[model samples]
Target chain A: MDAIFKDFGKAYAEFDGYNLAKTLAPVAPEAQPDRLYNFHRSTNFSSVQKDFKSKILHNNALPFKLTSEESNGWVEVYCAYWKAVGEILNAEAATKTHNKVSWGKVYEAWKEMTVVLIRGYTNSGFQAWTVPCLYVAGKYMRVFAIKADEDAANNPSSAINFQDDFNPEAEKNEKLEDAARQLNRMFQICLSDRAPLEESRKWGIYNIINLLFKTYFKLGSVSLSKNILKALQAYRGDMPPLDNFPLSHQVTFKYYVGVICFLEENYVEAEKHLTEAWHLCHKDAVRNKELILTYLIPCHLLTTHTLPTLALLSPYPRLQDLFLPLSRCIKKGDLSGFDAALIAGEDEFVKRRIYLTLERGRDIALRNLLRKVFIAGGVEEAKEPNAPPVRRTRIPVAEFGAAISIGSKETMDNDEVECLLANMIYKLVLFGAFGLRRRIYRLHMKVCLAQPYPPPIRRDFSGGTTSRT
Target chain B: MSAAPQSGSAPTTNATSSDKNADPAKDTKPAAALEEDDEFEDFPVENWTQDDTEVPGDNTHLWEESWDDDDTSEDFSAQLKEELKKVEASKKR
Candidate 1:
């Protein structure tokens, strides 16, 4: 202590009182001026009435009002919508519940909330902190809640009354091609009017489309999915990045295309879009990025069959904790463990395609056989017959194995013959037509066989076969 | 003439006043000029024109000082107008 004090004394004397005061003078901490908040007021029935007026409603964007209560109004609205959704669901005791939940009340709550932000800020001019989010949240909450309700009701054991939830029949919901068209038109409207107010514009057409995508997915509307693809493709006319807009919106053209790929079960294309979307998603937006990547990992695994281990995803050191478990489950072929990891991902709070167990579990289970084809020294190495059996390709096995992260070097040696042959034959059956990819895959087949076989992997489930053995 | 000397004046006062109040003849120690210059010397007019990063943080006043050479405000505004025109034109395309 004396040595340190002497060193400091030699360099800088202890600041005298006046000198220290000058050095540590108080910073002018910015004090925000008082803001006007609307509280203790009854719901504005007149404004809700005025919503239908010609003066307010323009081109299907019925302007609505949302009051900014001083304390936790946004969260309160969310809770309110949650209640509304639950009430509608509880009423389903007597009704036929076949399709996904409609969650009309929650959707209505979201719609009303958007009206609040649009009305309060864009029209009446209040601060646009998170009212728009309520709109998006309510919309998707409605979709997922409805879908969950519908699915729950349909299951024999967990059967809640479906008839009361909503009146739509499963076949009718599918048959109503026009409903999907209406969803497109709704998105078109969301995208149609350029928001005059920059803040309200956060709930841009892109945001609405994303909400619709999730909602429609929840409803199991394949028809809606196809329409979303068309709308997205058409909407891809160039867009300049808006001021203060997040990076996710920057690559949205690619995003919608990826959503389409996921629906079509093109795991490769899904991963391509979803990965870009996840990366392009704002770094601080903790939940949504996690949600998107949750789907992306499985897509990477499904298409490539390689799980990104802790080492690969370490740059995002925060998510590395979740990565290890998810990767472990996939590599070990522990379905339940994989399912646990899918839920265990740090971003369970966000509603997205990849993170949600409902979407990813079944998809991964079905796609594992497909992804197992391209391990570095594993499946790709085992069955090499035609070529001179080089030890391994000069193109570093690490280069090809880059995306397909397998921690166990032994996985390559474990089940080489079965996984590789399965990969080859599956490719032969599924994509052997006279296309460029097919031709390339044909070359890949020769390359696949020329590599040495791996010993069979210890598997509870059979590999390389899509069907039950 | 230099920004360093002008801001340097404030810290010099601090040192001189503290030392003078402590004792006048001992205050004749040239620590005021030396100590004051140590902190203020880093912020030089030479640095003002070098690069945006040299200023560090959001020192808008320093940035404004860097462009004080010929009152380029008008020319800068005109250039921005041109950029806006290009933005609008590209959107039209």
Candidate 2:
């Protein structure tokens, strides 16, 4: 058995994983008096090899065999080896790398051993739960990303941060994030099916998406902006639909998406998504809502074709100076400045969005229940009779603002809150909240009329709404 | 010809073609079953379908016969003994 195995490896080392596969056709030692019955001589080697190769090309990660049957186990093992092959492929893809094979071919041979394991210890392999090699192979992908980033950081032409219209290279980065996000989809499917072993393997794959987003944003790259929204949809599907996520997650998600929309120049949609996120954002969470809202002002003003009055700029004092240059850019439609702003601050804005999405999803249910108690007029048990006159005051202005921002923390009952929300949604229905947009419109109109020159009608839903939806 | 097997996601032309190959109970090309082709797809070479019987490198380096009497082969034992003595000598010296 040892000699035959060694002979097989020696014979197959030169051919890439596929050519070596052709050798399977001749492994019928069974017809001879001397044969090792350690493998299945069933399927044609070419078909098996081709199937294994295809899955690896699509995803660097492959599922380990965990089924009760031999046929399924073979399929899983084949997928694992193909993924290892993907690693070598990925490394070959790096520029300035040398072509060749060496001691590293041992990994490829280990994949071949899966054939023996399935034929020899099919049930025991499943029982022993041997890990598939895809785990090792997938690490090469992260290594690829880090290497590419390091290269780009040192290159002069790579100065463009984030996916601006100027940076054609950003498209490839977007594809990488898309690939990572796909892992989350597979993980949820495994979790839902109650396959713990399979699910654990997929965990790293999905987490890479999160890590990738963090990495790209940290470098001021806007590559994850679009893909993260898609990932949010994936996360949204994992949790129940339409419930408030954790307040914190909602805040961050809203802020980042808002920033992306601002960068993308879809001001109306950006503002809507960001506003919805803000309205639902938590109080205890960091003031990303404020930051996102600061950017949102530019989004709104640009879209509405109105100038920010000195009075209106009072709320966001930190932004007054930065706002002027952007205002000039917006006035002239200087896209470069907007791109620069996004590229310069892409990380902080994007991080805020991710943090908000998780926070929103996590606390949506809790916030709704908490809001119920507040709406039901439940108060902190009457402060022990005579605790400083009970403060007998109306809601603080800040608390009122907080209550409005945290959509679930209102004094209104569920029905009233629902009614207000519906009114906002059905603006055409002539509901009171629906009329609120008309006021936002009138204010914009007035501001435009007062200005010497105006660009166009700016919609409030400019940035946030467009980015998320 | 077809949609390139969804770039690794779906069974593409390769899989479809292989489906047309020999028996299911005993595969003729088992090495293809362990395909690393998808991994090294651009290796400037591909699987040896009947259409591609002529491989690039010298295929004459036969190793199949080496296994005929490999069980009693003294090469591995002698190499192991030499390796052990080297380590033992290094420790003593």
Candidate 3:
């Protein structure tokens, strides 16, 4: 115990954050015999407090003596750390025995520990290093909150009473929501710090933001994630460049920002962020890469009217299954096949919140079919010698109707086919040319004659013109 | 077409297309069955350099510019011929 205090005192005096965090962290059950194991076993709070005071405060070997105020902060933090650890161990033992009631105790202990740690954040020379300790406390607070919520939901008596005072606006996971509030306080602390960069709490901002991102996403409150981004944007100049942060922080920030843009249907911005995340992401992180690609592939299809090649998807079998058939049908201009593929992957697409975006790919398929029609209309011969031969731009409406009927299941009347053409023109899948009333669909001469006719499919579902070529 | 499938409510043309190829088993399965496996994972190491990532270069091989293949025009033209013939026959009937 004396040695443990000696090490803690040494780390605290030197502001050695990593080592300080080590002292606070609970020992794993599998760790071999060590002096730290004795600290872990010291479940009596009063005795532990006695040892901390006698060994750490009085010991002359620490090289520097802590001020009374500093020693008070340390005493509080040290005692709270062990108290939370003890409750966590109790909770684990209870979990082994399927004792659900003890979970709330773990959450309470961690909540208190987090408060103590937050107070400790204001202590001079401890602000930067103690961020990890706050993270651990907040993380477990949310975890145990979830466990407690699940236990309450599963318990019959609790469920029976849950309906009595249930308000639709009330949080279903009260404890978890409280954890988010506490995390927000930490976020505020980090953001409001005006200290020099070397010792500023600002360094902790992304870590807290990442934790908030996880919490809000788990709570299905994605809009709150936007608030975090907006706050970061407000402080953009004060904050360090994203690249200066750890790779983990950069990759995680980009990935979440990308997904948020994705959910908002901002495909272009989403593509930019998700692509950066993909490039910066660790090569060994196959799952993270796959996740980035999950949103990225759809963004690519929507923004650039492109498809992922088999080689691009070979590494991710699940994505291949989700996207391959859809890509194939779009390329072939097979309307029925596209519809079938969409239906088959509907659940997965909706789960990913990308069903609407992928639905727009049908326009691309129709555009390809229309492109084939223009290509089949080979160039008409030039009337005079030395004149350029003009590519055919005008085709009988019946030709398009024929193509549509062949691609779909049933034959359509001319009026129905014309309506479909009108929709395609509006979508910019087929560049609108005048003469629909005459039953001859005149394609835009320049657009249709371009090598890849009808231009790339540019769809703007936001009711804006698809002016992007 | 007389047998128009269900018309969708959205402005985008949800033409009543045939579902002969759609697998009922696939459609009927609950959405939750397709578990989201690509969740964000914590990094094993807190920091690394660009060297730890994939060597960035041309990304063209992954994305194809145009959906068309070499044989697409020929196949489409031949199919259009057959379909135009069918349309002509239907008009005559």
Candidate 4:
């Protein structure tokens, strides 16, 4: 215990934030036999305090000495850390004994620790290093809050009084909500830092923002993520280039931003961000890579009429099952097959908030079918003498109607087929030129003669002719 | 091309033809198993460059042109011919 304080004191005096964080973190269960945190075994706050004071503050034999001012801040932070660890110990004991109340106590203790740690951000020499400490405090605070909330829901009689005055309107998950608010305070502290780049609290920005993103996403309050992005954008000029940040920060930031754009139907921007995240992502991060590809693959399908190859999907079996059927259906221009695949993956896609985007692939299938129809038309001699013959691009509407009926589950009347054709023409004009000339379908060869039909460009399907740029 | 509205009259034939032609089992699997850990976490690595990526080169091998040029193969061509013959026969009727 004395050596633990000595090392902590040395790190503190040297302004080594990273080591301070390591020292401050609660000892993991597997490391219980280690003497450094053997004090944790005592499970009493005052006794630990007695040890901290006698071992470091009152002992003149210690190599590092703290001034009175530094001693005051150190004592305060130490007390907060000890209280949090004590509550955690209590929570663990409670878990063994199935005591619900101790979870709430743990949450409250960590909440207090977060508040105390925020003060270090304003301390001149300690500002830069406070981030790691705050991260630990904030993360566990949320974790325990979630546990507390679950306990409250499961055993309402033991619900902790989260506020001084109870309001009848207190919503469920109030504990988690309060934890989010505390995290927001930490976010603000980092954002408002006016210090120079070297020791600025601004360095903590992405880490805090990432935490907020996780929270917002879990709460299903996706719109709130946009506010964080707005705030970051407002501070962009003052902040360092994102590329200069840590890779974890960069990848996490881009993933959230990409998913946000994806939800907003901004496939182009979403693809750009998600692709960067995927490319720069760590090789061993299989789960994260799968998550990135979860959104990235749909964005790829929409923005560029492309599907992930079997090799890409092979590594991720979940992605393979979710995407392979859809890609095969689209490639074959099999409308009924596409519908079946979409319906089969509907639940997972909807859970990922991508059902609507994947639903748009039906248009591509229809376009491919139309492309095949044009090819089947073969070539026709030009009416004018000496003019090179052109691929037969003009055909009756019934030909398309037949292909449509052949691809779909039910045979459609001419009217329904025409409506489907008109809709496809409006959405996919760039794929091939189609004109309904007196009930005859004219597939214009001029726009793409060599490649008679290209992939359709992404367009807005929400009741407007305005194409997506 | 058949001008007759055969599709409207023989709905069963069209339905069965599409069902036989569009086999959905070639590459697909059962619905994907639910994802276990959906939440994103910070990567273990704080910083890395392209050297650290799983795949070394440009990701050309990962994505391919979606259009299948061989779509005009025997089966699809045969199906198209049958459908066109149906249209022409109906028009003559």
Candidate 5:
């Protein structure tokens, strides 16, 4: 057994070293000065793949083959898969010329090669390595496809000849979607107990799941994303510790889940996840940290009525630009200012799809308005001596309307005011409803009055909150 | 293209913690799955711009910066003013 393991290790190192040398080898200095050199290298790659298959294919004695033993054969498979794909990426980066080797043909071959490599790795149960490799490779494919599409769209050459109006990006999108679906299938395989879930492999699942979410987001397939989140949640028991993932994956996963929940208007859960992501993210990952906070600040406004402090927004200038005006309006109950800020930021918000989420901030403004009326209505005398004075309740809906009208340039009617109040009640920003009609709810002002700010997240759950699978 | 009323979310319902624990596998029936049309019912944005992924993660500044150039803000503000006017007009009616 010891000898077999040793032999596997030796074979893996030899295979990997040879591929690295082959991939890195500079084009022979002067062998082919013409463009035909690309063809020569392509032929060389085919011969190398053939030699690789003859040596490593169907070797029953390879370590970690059928039984649960360490096998060096996995590395050779990994290196070969990477070397094949790496050649294309490296060559693309080597020159400024686009489509020198015909992207259409290369992508078709890669589509085939990805399937074979994935199938072979899965059969051997070497998921830990294979999943991460595939995750990154999948990301590169998505990025490259997008870059190609952009190039095709912007390349002046295409503009010169309007007759060939074929859209290459349409094909690229289909290929990317196909690749995403394939990765999802492989992820399902990795979820089983038979695949090795060693520490490193455990972290790889986060990367795979995150990339899957990105793909779904890009596809704008919300139902598919929802299904994937549900699937991941159901398999929660099998996942590793949340701390095991790299900070980027942890933050990215929580951000997506939080944004999804916010879209569904599940404010409480969104607050929980976004808060955790904000605090746990690496402080140096400035942009990501800022992105998490952008969603988080709005979640806090909705759930707790707490505004972000100047101190909090100081470190992130971009976030401050996004949230400061909105927060100030929510604080002062400036309805017009809030609307103006939202409109000013409309394109940015719509692009991020946070317009709907932040639109809910209007509730904060309304809450502040109602609270002002409560304060101005004055406190009635306490029932007993040495008791705190209770604020007056049951202020007329007409009075709230007048307060709302002050924030607007146009006059507001009683029914418009009632409609606004009804919405407030429906959203649960206010409690106790005795009537709904021409009249708004008769309030049990105590519920609205009792220091309505939400408590801060407890320390125990802040940094260590595990995602629902 | 069917002119369904844009805002279709049935007023906010309390999100129960049970949603956290419900096993999704047991409820895999396709009919029960949330439909695309249903989810987008409350989506207020009429026109979605193309991919916002200029930079990998921090595209907020990209949108803001791009809109600053070439009157995007003015266009969106006009659209917003028009929508607000419709709401006001509806309430008056």
Candidate 6:
């Protein structure tokens, strides 16, 4: 393979795009592949031969049976595909769309061209020059995906989010999945090749992974994102140290992992990754920074019972809008107030998908309420003279009811108050003891009151008022 | 959005007053002032769905592929380790 590539490299050395600064100039978007198809294939043979060089090294793992003629033909196809890539990237970046190339059309062309490349390369390995080209193309997938999202958001016809209706992105997924698979194929080839990836080539892998992550996220298939992370981890020693990676990869990886941990209620791990993401995130990328803090703040509240201060939240008004009321309620130990704050921000939190995590912040409210109850209870007298005067740790259900009822408009029943306490205990927001003197649980309510709450007590359904209902 | 910190507990209600005012219906009007909290209890926590966070950017979402914006960023791996250690220490006692 090397010998063939060496020969190919010699014949086309001067024509390689790397050396031809002139070719970097944007081609008129109108003079795209559609126009190229009308030209005689033989007319550009000399120029094609000049341009199709072996700057891209081949992978030895999947060698192809190619005569010189066949190799030259593949080179022409690869060059044509890359040419299309450059044209689209350039046009996409232009401030004004002079000859606005339909991204859908460009994406379609990318798919057709990449299918041929994948089949050929799976049988015979890839060239290193193709790596960056493939990476940039993968990056362009975001543009296409965003365009699809925008179209959905804008078109009132597509705006309705119907549960029973078929997904509008079904066709979009077919295109996105094809693009993602092609990118993954190139990435896998880069990974499994006999030689280690060069420092310059490693960015291609990260770019490919990040692109795939975004595509999966948009598809709402986070399991695929999990698979990508697992695959990347398997190549840990083979790849560069994570610190040496581009910042985009670092932030994206941590953000995904942090969010996944948060969804799973692993607040400890979530806080770790999210804090790293927050610190390393670009200061000026205000939106991205806010996104990081969105999850990070919730993780902090759940794990440490600390709320974002006014100073910390001042700069990001959106965050302040989202968190200010909730923080106030948590600080004040107001269950109803916390619930109110959550209600006020439900739409925003649901839109951001942090509602579940923030919902868990009620545990913080419960903790505060229990703490207040303990303080308000003061010192309970010992039943026996020998018994030590204990701090009012033994809280009656009635006291909890009174405390909870203060901020709540309705009078809560004893059973409802007990259920709330039970939930608090179950969620580990409050810890205490259990002293049940009787097996007859119907009479145990009074006995349980003097004792710290314990789990596994059969709930009384006779009250017909348990809040758990 | 209102920056008022009036959510905190008012200490004017001493133990004696609270005992005297144990009638929940009599005190209900004060709680009614916060009608937002009333609706808050209806939020369905157990049924809340976990979905993906959106990719951040404003309208006209053109961006470059290279992540060079964070050139002077701190070492996140070290910071993560430091944070994890702190959490572990707190958990121990």
**DockQ in order:** 0.01, 0.01, 0.23, 0.22, 0.01, 0.01
Give the distance in Å from residue B4's predicted Cα in candidate 3 to where it truly belongs.
68
Evaluate model 4 with DockQ and give the value.
Answer: 0.22
Which residue segments of model 3 deviate by more than 4 Å?
Answer: A1-16, A26-38, A98-101, A123-125, A156-159, A162-165, A168-171, A376-392, A406-410, A432-434, A437-469, B1-39, B73-81, B91-93
Alpha carbon lDDT at A5, candidate 4:
72
Worst 10 residues of 6 chain B by lDDT: B37-46
Cα deviation of B75, candidate 2, in Å: 98
Q: What's the TM-score of each model vs. the native?
A: 0.37, 0.27, 0.80, 0.80, 0.60, 0.59
The C-alpha stretches of model 1 lying farther than 4 A from their native spots are: A1-186, A192-203, A238-245, A248-259, A302-305, A312-469, B1-93
Q: Could you tell me which 10 consecutive residues in candidate 4 chain A have the lowest summed lDDT? A: A441-450
Mark the regions of model 6 whose C-alpha exceeds 4 Å error after superposition. Answer: A1-101, A112-130, A145-169, A197-203, A378-394, A434-469, B1-93
- Top-scoring candidate (lDDT): 3
* Worst 10-residue lDDT window, candidate 5 chain A: A26-35
Q: What is the TM-score of chain A in candidate 1?
A: 0.41
Residue range A1-469, candidate 6, lDDT tens digits: 2322443344345333222211211121122322222222322445644544443423233233445544654665456565555444433423122343344555555555555555544554444444544544455444454443344345434355567866765654565666667667867865665554552345456656766666666667767877777887887777877666656567666777887777778889988998776655655556667777888888877676567766567779999899888876665566788898898899999877789888887776666655655554457799899998867654455555656665567867867877776676555454543334335332222222222223444444354222322
Name the TM-score of candidate 5.
0.60
State how far residue B5 of model 6 sits from its true place (Å). Answer: 58
- Candidate 6, after superposition: displacement of residue B41 in Å? 36
lDDT by residue (A45-134, candidate 2, tens digit) is 457555433432332232332233643454455544434334333332221133322213323343344334334232433321222222
Clashing residue pairs in candidate 4 (N, C-alpha, C atoms within 3 angstroms): A247-B46, B2-B87, B2-B88, B3-B91, B4-B91
Return the top candidate by DockQ: 3
lDDT tens string, model 1, A1-469? 1221122223223322223112111111112100000110112334422222221222133123323232133233323433333333322311222333343333444344434433333344333333333333333343434433444345433444467565445433331232333344445544544544453333455545654554465455646657765755665553333323434443443455575686567878887777666544444444444455555665665554445644336555545665566654444323445555666663542434345433343333222322332222332343657755443322222222221222223324213433433453444322211111223232122222221222332222222112212
Worst 10 residues of 3 chain A by lDDT: A28-37
Cα lDDT of candidate 6 equals: 0.54
- Candidate order (lDDT): 3, 4, 6, 5, 1, 2
TM-score of 6: 0.59
The TM-score, computed over Cα atoms with residue i paired to residue i, of candidate 3 is 0.80
lDDT of each: 0.37, 0.36, 0.71, 0.70, 0.53, 0.54
User: What ranges in model 4 sit over 4 Å off?
Assistant: A2-7, A27-37, A54-67, A94-102, A122-125, A156-170, A381-390, A429-469, B1-37, B74-81
